[model samples]
Target: MTTDRISRQDARRNAIIQAARACFRDKGLHGTSMADIAREAQLGPGQIYRCFQNKDAIVEAIIKVIISARVEHMLAVNHDLVRKADEFTRSLAGIAAFDSRDDALLLEISAEATRNPRIAQLVVEADLNLFEQGCAMLKARYPHLDTIQVNALSEVMAVLTEGTLLRRHVRPHRPIDAQCLQSNYLAILHTLFPDTQSNNTRKKD
Candidate 1:
């Protein structure tokens, strides 16, 4: 009930989530157990259970953290891209370079979502949050576009970004060319905003 106690509780909960993420990345969702997470966090099962009722609760918390971070990043990138389209392409390239562990963890969560009703609901809620934030960013940038157009554009962007993440996990060995990534992103931007010019202007020799 005290502030210090609440802070400690939150810290412990976050530690559990981090441990669960690492364990999930290495052993996968089905392979991971609450005992594995407890060992990874260096905490006893009692402590973990004090914070989360079960592994599913921990998984839901992890999904919330991951999705919240992603939504924040996407909102920031969208704001910058409105000012300069080059930022958009650069953001995609940055995503293309995420750590393999992150790819694995996300893929694992996605796979689990398909079979688990609770995880499926969490994923759907997270996705809706993302879509709403994306829609707001688009509306702010392109006020001229109607609601339908903005929604469609946001959906396209989300699909493309998610696809990029999936591709990295599914084909870890395939090298993504920075130039091609940028070019493809630019093409998408150009299609969406035909009047806007990308800041990148390297003349082809």
Candidate 2:
């Protein structure tokens, strides 16, 4: 009820979420238990239950954190891309810097979503939110593009980005060549927006 009490509750909840994320990343969803999370959070089982009803609740919270962070990153990247088409290759490379553990956790979540209705719904909602935001950014930046084209391009971009993340898990030992990724992304950009490419060339000339 008091401000301090609310702050404490918020802090405890966040601590539990962080612990759940780490546990899930290491042991995966099925492998992890509420007891594991409690140990990781340095809290008693009863204390953790005070904040979250069950392991599923903690898992959902972790997913929310991941989605929120990703949406923010996508929005930032979208803003940069709209303002600086010439720097699109650099931006692509920036987004490609993947963390192995995070990628693994994402793969785990994807697999779990196949059987977990709640997680499936959460993933669907997060994806639609991301797609809408991406579409808005693309529509604003390239008003000449028709609605269908904008939607298609946004879907392609999302697929490409997710594919890159998936690759990290598929080939954990492989080194990512930044230049190669940039070149590929630039080619995709040129194919998608040839007019912008020509305009950039003319500006440089």
Candidate 3:
């Protein structure tokens, strides 16, 4: 009897998680309700509430899922990316696109943070952690760039990318795209490290 109860509970929990992810993506964090999640999961509202105390809990869970997916994708960077800045940019940009669900939740989370101090704290911490990771990557590839320079560049990239994403998503027909972004970033890189240009590097093939 105990084993059967645990199995049922696990199933219900997984169902809610899966459903919440879909509902959150389809409906922004504010737009989604517990009832919507229940319908998505084919469960009753009580089932969602039983597993998650409230709508905030569901949003937190969805963000966690999306965050985990992003972290994993970021970890998959190719160390052999020294000769290929464009490839590295694509991999870095891919961290956000691990799933379309990520972009949806991130935009909503940004909005939520503006209204809630606790949520704002989470966003700050998460962005810092992610920026640190990006800085580490920069260190690995371009050890010549000092810590201060790395942090500065990472901050610039983070803000620019976020703004670009917001514009792209909210205005899908917008002229901005990742290629344009890469070109702009490369220009920055060229100015920042003129010494590292392809002509300066004997390794360029």
List, residue by residue over 94-161, the lDDT tens digit for candidate 1: 54323556656877888999889988888788889889888888887777778999899988877777
For model 1, name the residue pairs that clash: none
Clashing pairs in 3: none
Q: Output the number of the TM-score-best candidate.
A: 1
| Candidate that beats the other on lDDT, 1 or 2, i.e. the better one | 1
lDDT, model 1, position 114: 89
Model 1: lowest-lDDT 10 consecutive positions? 196-205
Residue 48 local lDDT, model 3: 79
Model 2, span 24-43: residue lDDT tens: 98888989999999999999
Give candidate 2 misplaced runs (Cα > 4 Å). Answer: 79-99, 172-177, 194-205
Error of 3 at 134 (Å): 1.6
The local distance difference test score of model 2 is: 0.75
User: Using lDDT as the measure, which candidate wins?
Assistant: 1
Which stretches of model 3 miss by more than 4 angstroms?
Answer: 1-11, 79-97, 172-185, 189-205
Sequence-dependent TM-score of model 1: 0.83
Q: How much is 160 displaced in model 3, in angstroms? A: 3.2
How are the candidates ranked when ordered by TM-score, highest leading? 1, 2, 3
